[model samples]
Target: MKLYVNNNLLLDNITIAESLKIRLVGLLNKKSLNENEGLLLKNCSLIHCFFMKFTIEAVYLSKDMKVLYKETVKPWRIGKLVKNCTHVLELPEGMTTGIGIGDNIILEGEKNGKGQ
Candidate 1:
């Protein structure tokens, strides 16, 4: 799977972390994220960077896929809790320059978050 913006923004391959086990181990076991890779956590609002080896960009999105909040978190840090967010996109650090609040994001090959 992949994450996109404005139909073509970013175009990064992503792993859908919907299950509790996947979400809990998100990015923790990985040493680094490629420039074109990411993680999308379904039904998530907050995140932590404890034991992480690198920084990352976190984008909180609503169920409709609208950007609700964004932040840059470093290793061993806790991200701010965002309200009204149903998904959280994790990307390589500093990769969120083009995204902004209210912007609509899309997941490749999915509609309303249901895998196609």
Candidate 2:
């Protein structure tokens, strides 16, 4: 999938982590994330970087996909719990330079012609 902010492309090939196991192991052992890669954690409000090897940009979104807050978190640190956040987009650090609070997010999937 592709992630966009107000129609501006932010990243591509995004992964959605919704299961308890997937969400818990989010980016923990990964040494780094590519510029076009990101993980969207569902039903999350708080995030931490404990034991993380690289810094990351966390964009919290409301249930309606509105941006609630953004944070550039360093390794081994914890981020503030944002209110009304139902999803968290975790990207590589420095990838969220132009994103702003209250921006709308758009997710588009690949064009798979499976005869829908």
Candidate 3:
């Protein structure tokens, strides 16, 4: 899959199966994450899991790759749909610097008809 932030390509042809094995420390030090220090995206879910903590940031996205809604949730927190979200992207703390509401995130992957 490919990840684009504000139309800027970040990761091209990234296979989540392999990327999933990335540890927290390496993810935190990754530079090309477009302000997002860490990412845990699979299929359509973006989960930023803090192994040392109890918090996770979840952002649901639409089919067109727009952020439908976002939530900073803990383990006990429940998730709800604020919009028609088909995907989700999670980021580490303080990683959403230049991003905001209505921002469009373009994702090209096998699931979205863009085969790798």
Candidate 4:
């Protein structure tokens, strides 16, 4: 799957971490994420980068795909919890440039092909 912001391709090869275990281990122990890859955590608002080796841009999204908050979280740091956020997108630093608060996001499925 891929993530698009205002019809602009944002992240490809998206890994949806909907399960508890998957969400718990999000981006942990990973060496790095490709420039076009990211992880989407369902039912998540806050994130910790305790075991991550790199920084990431975290985008908090409401259930309706509204961008509620965004921040560049460094390794060993904790992201802020945005009220009413039902999902969280974790991407490589600078990947979220130009995306701002209140921007509507779209989660494109594989049917559209990768990175579309």
Candidate 5:
């Protein structure tokens, strides 16, 4: 369940803890998240239900894959911009630090040859 950008490993199957109530309303494999493309959720929202062992670097996105919010969320922290968010991209912890909001993400990498 690792999130990747081309050959670059963004988040390696990081745990999505219960701290966030994330309802996977719509899902696509690697093809869904595009390089330089944005994610837009049409009919669903992601919820964070707080619990234990929740490991994720949450990257909040708008309908056009524009970065709306970001946080290196663990077990107890709250996810920002829960509302009005069209998509949530979870990267590895520290993968998105200092990356300003409203900016587009450029997914870069090659196929690392590692299989889940």
Candidate 6:
């Protein structure tokens, strides 16, 4: 799937990591993330880069798809806890420049034509 912000294709390739195993492993052991690729961790509020090799941009979103918080996390760092966040979008650093707090994020191929 893809992630779109404000009707613009932000991440062309998106992987939804909803399962416990997938979410636990996350991007760990991965060498790098493509410019247009990202991972969405469903039912997550915090993340840790303990075993990651590279930095990443983390965007916290509410259940309604509103961006609640965003931050750039370096390797071996920990992300802040976001209240009421239902999922977390992990992307390459600087890819979230245009996205901001309270922005609505849309996921392609959804029945509602928007993220849930």
Top candidate on lDDT is: 6
* Candidate 2: residue 91 lDDT (0-100): 95
TM-score of each: 0.90, 0.91, 0.51, 0.90, 0.48, 0.91
Q: Report the number of clashing residue pairs per model.
A: 0, 0, 1, 0, 18, 0
lDDT of 1 at 5: 81
- Show where candidate 1 strays beyond 4 Å: 110-116
Clashing pairs for model 4 are none
Of candidate 3, the 10-residue stretch with the lowest lDDT total is: 23-32
Error of 3 at 21 (Å): 14
Candidate 5, 39-65: lDDT as tens digits: 222322453425524345667766655
Model 6 pairs in collision: none
lDDT per model, in order?
0.85, 0.87, 0.51, 0.85, 0.46, 0.87
- For residue 109, give model 6's deviation from the true position in Å: 3.5
What is the alpha-carbon lDDT of model 1 when measured against the actual structure? 0.85
Weakest ten-residue segment in model 6 by summed lDDT? 107-116
Using TM-score as the measure, what is the rank order of every candidate, best first?
6, 2, 4, 1, 3, 5
Q: Report the Cα RMSD per candidate.
A: 3.3, 4.3, 6.8, 4.1, 9.4, 4.3
With a 3 Å backbone cut-off (N, CA, C), the pairs that clash in candidate 3 are: 46-88
Candidate 1 clash total?
0
Off by over 4 Å in 6: 110-116
Cα lDDT of model 4 by residue, 1-116, tens digit: 87899888877788888767777778885899899888988878789999889999999999999999999999999999889999899999998887999999998885321221
For residues 4-113, write the lDDT of model 6, one tens digit per residue.
99788887788888667778888995999999888888888889999899999999999988999999999999999999999999999989999989999999853211
How would you encode candidate 2's per-residue C-alpha lDDT over 64-96 as one tens digit per residue?
Answer: 999989989999899879989999999999988
> What is the total number of backbone clashes in candidate 4?
0
